[model samples]
Every structure is written in C-alpha cells, then in structure tokens.
Target chain A: MKKITVGFLALLFLMTLGGCKKKEKVKVIPPAEKQVAKTGEEVKEKPIPKPVVQEESIEDMSLEEINKKGYLQRIHFDFDKYNIREDQKPILIKNAEWLKAHPTVKILIEGHCDERGTEEYNLALGEKRAKAVRDFLISLGISPDRIKIVSYGKSRPLDPRHNEEAWAKNRRAEFVIIAK
Target chain B: MRKILIFMFLSLFSFSQQEITIRIKGGIPAIRIAVPPFIVRATTQQAISAAKEIEEAFRADLAFSRVFDPLSRDLIALVKDRNPEKPDLKAWESVGASVVFIGKVEEKGEYLRFVGKLYDARSKNFILGKSFYGKIKYRRLMAHRMGDELLKYFGQVPIFTTKIAFISDRDGNRELYIMDYDGMNQMRLTYTKGMEMLPAWSHNGEMIAYTSFRKGNPDLYIRHIYQGRDELVARGGSNITPDFSPDDKFLLYSSSLPGNYEIYIYNLRTKQRRRLTFSYGSDLTPKWSPDEEKILFSSDRSGSPQLYIMDSDGKNPRRITFQGSYNASPDWAPDGDRIIYVSRVLGRFNLYMLFLSTSQVIKLTSGMAMNENPCFSPDGRHIVFSSNRSGKYQIYIMDYDGKNLRQLTSKGNNLMPSWQKINYRR
Candidate 1:
C-alpha cells in the first residue's frame, strides 16, 4: 500500500512536469549548448540532484491516532443542498488542518436530514450531503481514501421532536473519528 | 422461491387453523359477541356514570370494530345495575351472547378509575383484562384504550390509539385535520386558512407530508404534527398523494409537472428530482410498496381510474388491477402481497383488494355508502377507511379480508385516514 501510494504520488508529480520537460530538452539540444552544459554537468556531477518537496500524502496518516488526539469536526450544509459552498471552505480547512497536523488519522461523516420528506428522499439526500463533504475534503489535498462517509437520512435524528428548532438541529452532517 | 414460499405459506396456513368447538360458520351473519355492561364496584353517584360511560365507549368501539356483535344493552339494562361481583353469568348466556364483558369502577379524588374483562361465553375464559385511571375529561381516552385492548384480544390491531389526517370543512374551509383513528381526538394539524389534503405520515411518526392549496395551487408541504411547524417541500402543479418510503429516505408522489399527473421521486439527500412517469393521462395517488420495490398508484393513463404498479425506479410498469370501472388510492399491505384501494364495482366506491401473485380480486366492501382512502395498519391485518354509511362521512376499520366492518366515528364528516405505524417504543 505504501509503495503504491508513493508510486501514485510520484506519477502525479511527474505528470505535472511531463509537458514542460519536453520543450526544455528540445531547447537545450543546441548541440553546441549541450556540449557546454555537458562540461558544466561533469563539473557538478557529484550526482544529478533530485528536486525534493515536503509533500505529505494522506495515506501515511492513521485516522485512529488523529481521533485519539481529538481533531474531528462535522461539516454542515444547507437544506436539501449537497454542494459544498465557499463559505463552508474554512470549516473544511480547519478539518484539513487537524488531519494534516495529526497524521495517521481517518474520519467518517454521517449525513442526516430534517424530517421534511419521505425516508428514501432523506437517505438519498443524506448520501449527497456526506458525499459533498468528502469531495470537498479531497479537493483540499486530503486523500479520498482517508475519509469514509455514510448516510443515516432522517432516521438517526439528533432531536426527536416536531418543532422548528428540532428539525433544524436534525438536518446536519456529523463527523466521527473512525481511525487514528 | 417456490420452496421458500411454500414453507412460509404453510406456516401462515397452520396458524389460521385454530380448533373451534362451536362452529362460527353460520347464524344471523353478525359476529356473535357480548359486551355486558360493567357493574360498578364503587358505591358513589359518579361511579354509576363512570362505569356506564366506559361501557358505552367500548360498545361504540366494539360495535364499530365489526369484529363483535355486542350483546343488547337493553337486556342488560333490564337486569338492574348492581355491584361488580354480583353478575349472573347465566343471564348473559340466555341472551345468546357468545362473549361477554364485565367491569368495576372507583373514585380516586376527582379522577375515575375502572378495570374490566372480556369473557368468551362458550369457553368461559377471560380474553382480556383492562384497567384505567384518569380524569373525567379522559374517560373517552380510557374508553378508546379499552376498545383498543378489545381489538387486540380478538387478534385485531388497536386502532383507537392510532389517528387520521384528512381534509375537512368543519372550520368553513378545507384544512388539515388530525383525529383519532376512530375519528375522535380531533385536532387541526394545519390551520393556515388554506386547503390541505392527502396527508401522508412519515414512518418515523414525527412529520406529515400533505398537499396545501395556500398558494392557490396544490403544493407539497412537510409539517411537524406537534409544533405545527411546516416547510414547503415541493411546488408546481397539482401535487398530491405523497407517500414515504419504508426507510423514510425518499418521497413517491404525484405531480402534474410534465403536463399531466405522473409519479416522481424527490431525493432529500441530493435535492435531485426525477420524474417517474410521462404517460398521456393523469397518474396520481402513488403508494409505496412495503418493500419499496414498486409503487402502486391510480392513473387515468389507461382511460378511467385504474391501479398500476411500476418498479421503484419507475421501470417495468404494468397494471395490477382490471376489475372495477374506477379504482384509486391503493395502499400496499405491509407484507407487500395484496393492495387495498377504493373501487367502484356496482356504483358505490368501496375498498377492494388485488392479489399480485394469483391475480385474485377480493371486493372487501359492497353496498351502502362510498368508501375511499384505505390505509393499512402497520401489521397489515386491518385497514382504516372513510365512508358515509352512517349518514355522515365517518371513519371505519375492517380486517384486510373484509370480514369485520365496524364504524369508528359517528360525530362529523371525517375522511381520508392515515394509519401510523405500530408504537415501537411500547
């Protein structure tokens, strides 16, 4: 798993420069320039130094450890809407910060809905809500495999009442520490 | 499938084969039952009415249950009211009562307390033991409780504690009214001065999805029953018959969004709406199957009102009914084999059933007034429907096979009953 992740990260980094390297090599092949650059390369040939960047891949992180450190946050969404908004970016960032700070951590987001419609609709709605949170996390450099999402729809409501306050409270997405 | 079904069916077949000493196959057609008036144990003035009122409540309850032919109160009326322990069992038997009821009452402060029992006349066995203690204002509730217990005694689901959500004009305008399943305990669920109808209950029992005409068009609104909180769920064209899925995850309902009425599914998670039908005629009154594999709905798509079924994903559509000239509002039994719907066979619209496996159609109701909107109990053994058989629109419940026909309410025009699921907490 570690080797595959390393290979995948390397591939992603290579894909980023694959296009620019072709033009650079073509321009450097002024044969005349290559000979001079070759002489310079020989002078500097302690070894061709590989560029290094401190990029942390989520694969190495243990969710159980992060959970033990108490760094989990729930992502909330507007009613019936699963698309994450710009305003909610900071919330995801905070979660990302916690995840990035505490490696080897994993999180699960359980999606819920207010009792406004049928159960099937709520389940689908809950799925979309949790998926939206997961997608947003992935875009923020969090590995897709790091987050696990499940939907409870309107069944596991936080408030079991027939009131506005109760409904609002029930329509939510909850984050739980699955592994750290 | 065959072997599994045979095993399952044999298990069901074995239970209904209960031994009967005295054959109940014949006689005057009325189910022989005896609800003997309660003899008050209390020696007080209020006890006289307290026990009698509870008895009267059960009388109405059982009589409407259609499961029992309550023994004549007149015969018991002449026997002279007395203390609880002094009833002559022989007197009840003489009146051809096959079953009997006995009770006693007490006064605890301003409240009334009562305990009762149902005795099988033939077996001479106590079938049910019921007790109650409540204020005078709650006598009816006490009575409903007794009635509900009586129903359970005879293998009937107690619907007295259940409720009905229907549209009514008692307030001079059509608004959503929630009443006891027996048509008592009436309260207004929606009082916006707008018309609300076709109320459907959420499986979790907290919310109600209904059609509200407050915006001058039929729109779906989800309203909390207790707090009276409501949110507009879906808008546009005549939206009606919102039925919740088994898991309460999605809504299957009818809307005229595509020029004519068609069933649609609205996913609460994704806020994505998908149209389920695009037929040429009106498709309305969509009911979810117990397993949520299919939906039973009424559609004029094939000409007059007829029942149709389609997969939960709106594929593989087919007609499940073909008998009656008109059939509408079909609710699938909890077991998912049979469908109960309102059908007009000989001019009167009454409850009927269509067996999906054998294509056998059973007309559960016939004659008298119009019966509409048959909602099955959570156990699927009974169905509560609306009818005008008792001179006014009132609610009635009957076994799924249409054996017991009992009137629930006689007070006002009550229509469209929605049965709540069994109280899981209790």
Candidate 2:
C-alpha cells in the first residue's frame, strides 16, 4: 500500500515536471508569433523556429562535449568484485536521477578491471561489474534501452601504476554519453 | 665426375633403421648430441651468412626442446668433421656425444638446400638423413624443419616449427603478433589499429581466433594468417576470448549479448551459434578438450571465478577448483591428464597445475608478481605464460616441471600467449 502511494506521488511529480516543460514551450511561441506578424500579413506561420528553440532547450551538444558535462557518475568496484558497495549507492542514485531527467540521452557504461587477473577472466569480471551497475539503474527505473555496457577488461586503465590506489580507480564502470 | 655421383648416391642410401627406440620419458636421461657448425658451400655473402644463422637457430631449437642434451661448444670444438658426408664418429664419441649431427648448407641460385645427417657415434651408423629445400629468406624455417625431423625420429611431436600467438602493446596498441617458439622473428599479424587480445591459434595453425575492438566494441575475429584475410566471427555486446575447436570448424567464446556473459559455441562453416551456459554469472575462457568431447572453462557462477568442466554440448557442468577462491584461465594440456590454470592467493597470481586423475594440485610458480594465461606447448612439455616479475609484463616459457624457465619476449607488455596446437598420432 505504501509502495503504491510512493509510486503515485512519483508519477504526479513527473507530470508536474512535464507541465513545466509545456509552459516553457508556450512561452517561446509568443516571440515566434511576433516574428510572423512582423514578416508578412498573408504568410503562413511555419512554426519551424519555435520547435528549434524548444529543441535547443536540451542543448545541441556533441557526444564528447556532452560527456564532458559529467552528469552521470562513474562507479568503482572493490578488487575482484562486482557487487555495488553500500557507500557507492548514493553516487548511483544521483546518476540514475540524472539519467531520468535526460530520458533521450543514451549512455555506454564501460566496465574496467585492475591488471591482476588474466585478460579473459578480467573481461568477464568487467562485464559483471557493468551489469551490476545496469541492474542497479534498472531498479531505480532507468530504461534498459538508454544504457549499453562494454567490458574493457584491463586494457584501458585510468591509472597505469601498479598499486592499490590505482587499482581502485581502474576497477570502475565509466559512463560515456553515446547519443543525445 | 662419375665417382662423385656414385658417392653421393651411396651416401643418400646409407640411412639405417635403428632397432632401439628413444623415448623421452621421465626417468630416461636426455640423449647427448653433438651439432658441428654447418658446412657452408655458398659463393654469395647472403647465403654464407644464412648458413651460419641456420646452424645457430637449429642448435637453439635443440636446446629449447629440453629433450636433447646438446653438446657444449667446447666439446664440439674437440672434433672437426670437415666433410659432413664422412663424419669421424669415433672422435665425436670421445667428446661424450652419443649422437652426432653433420649438416651441410648449399646455396643453389635463389634457394638453399640443407642436408642433415644423424649418426650413432658408438656404432658409426647413419641413423637418418634429411634434406630441407627452401628460399634463403626461410633459413630459420628450414633450420626448424631439421629440428622437427630429429624430434619425429625420436617419437615426439615436432614443436620447433610451431608459433606462439600473443598480444603485444609495443606498437602503441595491443595487436596480434606471432613469434617463433624461441621468440625470434616477432612479426605483427594485425593492423586493425584497435586493441586485440586473447588470441587462440587453431590446431591446424592456419587461423587465429581473437577478440578485437576495431568496431568500437570487442568483437571476435578469425584471421586466416597465411591467406591475409579476416572473418568477423561475432559482434554486438562485447565478444571476446575465442577458442578454436580441435578441427578448426567451430569457435567457443563468451559474449554479453544475452544480458550477461555466457559461453557460446559457433559453427565456423554454418555461422550458427548456440548458448552453452545460462547463468547470471560470467562464463569465460572456454577451451575444447583434446578429443572435443568436453570443454574446460572458467565461471563465476559459484560467487567467484573457478574452473569448470562440462560436456561439449553444455551438459553436466561441474566446478574443479576448490582450493583458491580466484581460479581462472584453465587450459587443458594435450596429454589430457593435467590442467594448467592461474590461481590468486592473497592478491598474488600464480600458475597451478592440477592433475585430473589424482586431484593433486601443484604450484608451478611462486613470486609476488602476476603469472597468468598459461598455455601448454603442442607437445605438452612446456608452458608459455605472461608475467610482470621484471616490472613489465613479458612472455616467458617454462618446463612442465617448473624448471628451466626462459623469457621469450622482452618488449612492451606481451600477454595472453596461445601456443599453436599440433595433433600427434599415438
């Protein structure tokens, strides 16, 4: 019963957010109406410039440029482990929220590992790490289509140094904005 | 001229069949053999130097075999057999050589011909003689053929001519490269400009199945090395760790296409694939058994990565490693009695050999460095693996008993070495 109530409230909040976006679209159209009135009395209003303004609300950014925004957080894993840590839950929640806000943004989660195990096993372990993150995101209501995962094994390390500190950084699932 | 022709014909027919068979068993000692410097009968400078190079390469192959005790340079200097056709066997025997090899390299226009004669020093009998003809550029290959001939005569698999395919980042990217068993002629095999890893050489040695990231994702690719063509085997969702079947008609690998990493077997001829494992845990590094009846793979279904064995059809799955919590990269030896794998204990990765019959596990390496991806040699006498004991990862070869360890590569971070598999008749 309490779960239903919470879900109902969440749906109401999403509806309210959608209502605000519609209001913003309404506000942008008045300027386009003023431009149409100034252009010609007999010309038909194409509304082409208005839709562009609304599309510009999300910012027409390249994949690399959008990824530089660092909206989604990279989650780190323990050595030789794929389970999400309790301390890292808050970071994933924030990332999930950001992903929820940007529904059209597609992400590629690259799972990585430390340079300890063999390449083949590490590749599998990296996939497990990525899947674990994807599962967590799914629990938080992120669509599966919005996220794709790849395991780089230990080939691409954030830090090339052979130490625990560097390994902790290397064993992470990095989020890349693939499409928007 | 007629006398010379007759002498040549007689020497060619002088090979005798020895009654005693030399088997390289555990208790038997390595046969003492003397290899005199090859007689160079070449007029050109290239051919003269090629003769000397071939001699050294052939001797190195013998030393690397670990089955023959090659005579030292000092012992070989004690006897000089100027005419390879007329070797002084008694002088070779005086230097404690049980067998002697007299080799002659002759340059014929654009090709080189190597004539090698093996003799029993005590009995003064020609045991066997072989002639290898090839271009001057294939000097090492011809030398390896001579070594292979000696190995075959002793009822052993010819491993001197086999190659080891591995991943090297020396060219700034991890690319597939193959080298001689002793690390000579390191040649890059792929120019995909993307990371290539986990190369598995086919049993016939005509193809190499490896994982590449050339298309932005790790995809399985089979490179027909000699033909200079590639066939994209699998794609979509991180395809990696391709192991060719014994007959080269199929490939077994792990892919993340079905929501998670799962073992899949694909028919190379028909291009059909079937999932072997249906588990949430990752199933990776699948290798075919010698007879192709079973498969040896690593799985994390039991909470941690462990070695697992199942039938070729993915039935009767069972875990084999219980001692270590982290056991992966299991390779079935050609003998079918032992398995070589990597196990991590207290963060240190080392190679371990498990006996399937007795269930006895022996540690093959002991160090603080990471020793991983160990594959058995074609003859199952040696293991090729990667290690970072020298501060950088390099390929190394060691005997099955863990002695006589030698480094095969010394370039930028070579890992995941797959020794070529050659089938031998029992």
Candidate 3:
C-alpha cells in the first residue's frame, strides 16, 4: 500500500510541473508569432539570449548615458527632403546593428526640422524623416515593434542660429532608447 | 391748421439734412475733430489723474479709427484752459476742427461718473452726450465704451472693445496672451512650460483653441476663457493651426496621423472628426470663410508652398495664388471678399491682400521687417499681424489698407495675432 501511494504522489507532482510549463509557453509564443506576422517571415526563431558583454555594458547605463555615448548616431537630411541620403545610410546601418544586438531594447526616433518652413508643414516633414529612418531599421531585421516615431517640427532646433550650416544641423533624426 | 403743417414740414427737412451730413462725413474724407483736456469735479489727486487718463484714451481711440483726424497735441494744449462742458467753439474752429470732444469726471462714492459730449464746432451744438459710471480701476474700459459710442454716432464700426489673442514668449516660454485692441490690459491665458501657438478665437469670443506642447507632443487644446478649463481635442501627432468655424459648430485644423499632414474638421457637439484634405503633401493653416462655404489653406502639392482654396466639404480644390513660390498663412477677410497671406519676395516675407473678385494682389507691407500671420479684425476694417521689425517679433495692428500702423506688443517674440469678435450684450 505504501509503495502505491509513493508512486501516485510522484506522478501528481510531474503533472503539476508540466501544467506550469505549458502556461509559460502560451504566454511567450504569441509575441513571437505577432512579430513574425508583422515582418511576414516564415522562420520560427526564438529571441537570442542577450550576449554577456553587451548586456553588461548596457545593464548599468541609463538611457541618457547610452545616447550620450553615441551608440546611435543622428542622421541628417537635405532641405525639405525626407529621403535617406547615401552618406546617411551607413549611420542608419550602424544604428540598426546596435538595435539588433539588443533585442530586449525599444527606441524612439525623433524627427526635427529647421525654422525655415511653417510650423505645421515642418511637423509633417519631420514625421516623414523619422519614418524613413524607422523603415530602414525595420528592413535591417530590427522588429518594427521596437521603434516609435515622434516629430518636433521646427519648435526644437539643435542650433538656434539662422544660417545654412545651422539649418543643416537642425534637420536631423535622433534615436533615443526608451527601454532595455 | 396751416401753422401746424408748416411746423411738421420744417422738422422733416431738418431731420433729412442731419442724416445727409452724417452719411457724407462717414463715406467721404475723414472728419476733423479737436480733443481738449478733461475737467475733474473731484478734489482728490487720483480722480484728477483718472480724468486725464480717460481723456488720453478717448483721443487715442479716435485717432486709431482713421475716420477722425484729431487735432495735434500742440493745438490741444492751446485749448487746455477752456471749460470742457462749455468748450470755446471759436478756439476749436480756429484749429480747423469740425467737431470737438468734451469730457468731465466726478467721484461718486466708490464709483466714478463720466459725462462726455461731442459738439459741432461750426454750429456750436451738441451732437451727442452720454454718461457712464464705473470703478476707478476700470477707467480704461469706461473710456473704451465712450469711444465705441462716438464711433457709432459717426457711422463707423466700433473696435475699441475687441481683444487680440497672440502668442508671446515673455515668460520664458511661448504662451497665449490677450490684450485690448489698443494694446492695454495685457493678460496671459496659458501658463504651460511648453510652447503654445496659433491661438484662434471662437465666433462668440468665449473660447480659444491653440496648439500646445505641454504633453511632450504638439496637441490641440480648446480652452474656455472665462471658466479657466481646457480639454485636449487631439493628441498623438502634430495638430496645429486651429480655427473655429463661423457657426462655432466645428474646428478646422491640420493633423499628421497615419501619414502626412491633412486638414481635419472636428465637430464640437458630436465629437467626431472628418478628414478634409488627402493630398500627398502637407495642407496646413486652414481658415474657414466667414460664410462657411469655403476653406483657404496653404499646400505644397505643387513642389512649393502656395495658397489653395476648397469648398467646405473638401471638394473642388482650386489654387488661388500663383505669383510667388512660397505663399502661405492665408486668412480670409471677415467680409469674405479678400484673402490675406504672406509671400516671400526677395527672400523676405511680407503681407499681401488678394481681392478674390478680381484676382488683384496688393502688397500691404513694405521695408518694415518680416511680417506674417495677418488676421482681420471683426469688422474687416483692420488687420493685426506680427513683425520682427523691432529687432524681435512683436504684434502690430494696421488699417485694412495697411495704414495706421501701430505696435501692440514689445516684449519677447510675439506672433500669430488673432482678433476676437465684438462681444455685444444681448
């Protein structure tokens, strides 16, 4: 009788553990599926475990420090142009690579413009600039869910001077880490 | 019976003559008038100073109307010693005055009573006489009321009681502020740490809508001026350049959502939004026609910014301006016959008025500074705009033909002036 009871107790414990594991799987699979569906990818790949070195470097650093360290470089555009230039492409590629290595991070892309245009039009133009950068990042295999865009129009200028050089500097797309 | 008939005919003839004189004086050249120093019946220093302030305000209002040529300060000083209640008609006529304004102030307990009279210098008869009562702190308002009465008597629209809403960065941030039409009694409306721009007054003058960055993104907010309450109208994107419809039933604005910027109208009562423009390029700064039949806006669909007009339903979009590569900030005149906009000429922005009936463009400002964001007063007889002529952006008011130019604000960068409608008591 004692032997039968021990066997039944061990079987019940195994079933309970299995039930918990199934629940965990249910919670984790939908996000991966949604991401794959968004990108229209067929491969079922699990999120890579964060690398030791990259994790250590970013684990203690705040968002401000990470941005200050220039892990993500700002991209510039020509006057009234939201298209990515040849020179700006490499910087975007570098930013995408950083984003890919840190799969657990989410970033915000801010679009800004100079004071030459009307405020309302500049706002739309800035959003286009940010969207261009975001699309480029998504094409580089960074999940679209990891990036968000907001435009500052001509309200916040990096350089307050009213000149060509200042305007060129003012019109830019900056990346900020929102969460890691 | 014959004597009675003669008396009736004489009275009718005199009435017709008075009407004819008023019509000719208002429709033709400006009326010449002289303003003498006001008389104070009180003994206190405050009452005396209040009387002088009232006199100054009355003179300024008349001069601003552009329909009355007040006597020069030198001529006014010459008639200073004459009694205001019984002004020396000979002295005023010597200064070429056709009319004169006489005023008296007396203390009445906690209130002050002002009696003002308009006299015809040639006939030596009072054309109009009125009395007003108010607290000493409200002396300017009392004077403004008197000025409006005088304007009505001369067959001109009263502008003294109207207020101008504008954006100023005086408090270390761009915020909404309002002041009297003549630039007195300035008050700040929004105390946000972020930027507020493009203030639009409702037709009833009870509420204001503006774009504020208080929530880290530019959003549209409508504020009840008297209640001090504000509600977010739109969020999550750049929403700006809001204007209340003529009926106050909808708010027309531009929003960047789902794609590029497009004009959208928000129904005030239903709380529903309907997109008005769907162009690939940005369409912004929409102003509803006074009759609510058309919308005037700036669009860059033709590779450069230009003014465009469309029906209120966003159909039959047509281009109205073709002269400049950059024509923007179009505000339709209150009468709906002309449109005012800014154009870049020789790399400098200046205000231009385009008569819609004839397609005639007239440059309203020249060689002052960058003048932009011009709005029409309630009667469409005047325009208020912002200029950087004083080494910084400041609000300015000028007549419809760009005459009577006066500065309204001096501190910080003030821009985007919107004139409120006259609030008449029902």
**Candidate 1 lDDT tens digits, B214-259:** 8645588888777779867788645778888877778878775565
Q: What's each prediction's clash count?
A: 30, 0, 0
Clashing pairs in 3: none
Candidate 2 stretches greater than 4 Å from native: A1-60, B1-29, B80-82
Structural similarity of chain A in candidate 3, as TM-score: 0.68
lDDT accuracy of residue A17 in candidate 1: 94
Candidate 3 runs further than 4 Å off: A1-56, B1-29, B77-83, B86-94, B122-125, B367-369, B422-426
* Models sorted by lDDT, best on top: 2, 3, 1
Angstrom error at residue B247, model 2 = 2.0
Q: Judged by lDDT against the true structure, how good is candidate 3? A: 0.83
| Rank list by DockQ | 2, 3, 1
What is residue B221's positional error in candidate 1, in angstroms? 1.8
Q: Which ranges in model 1 have alpha carbons more than 4 Å from their true place?
A: A1-180, B1-33, B41-50, B73-100, B118-128, B202-206, B246-250, B266-281, B324-326, B333-338, B342-352, B362-426
Q: How well docked is model 3, in DockQ terms?
A: 0.37
lDDT score, candidate 3, position B39: 73
Best by lDDT: 2
**Model 3 over residues A1-180: C-alpha lDDT tens digits?**
999999999999999999999999988756666778899878756787666664357878898877788789999999879999999999999888888888899998999998766656677788889999999888889999999888877767898776789999999999989888
Residue B170's lDDT within candidate 3 is 88
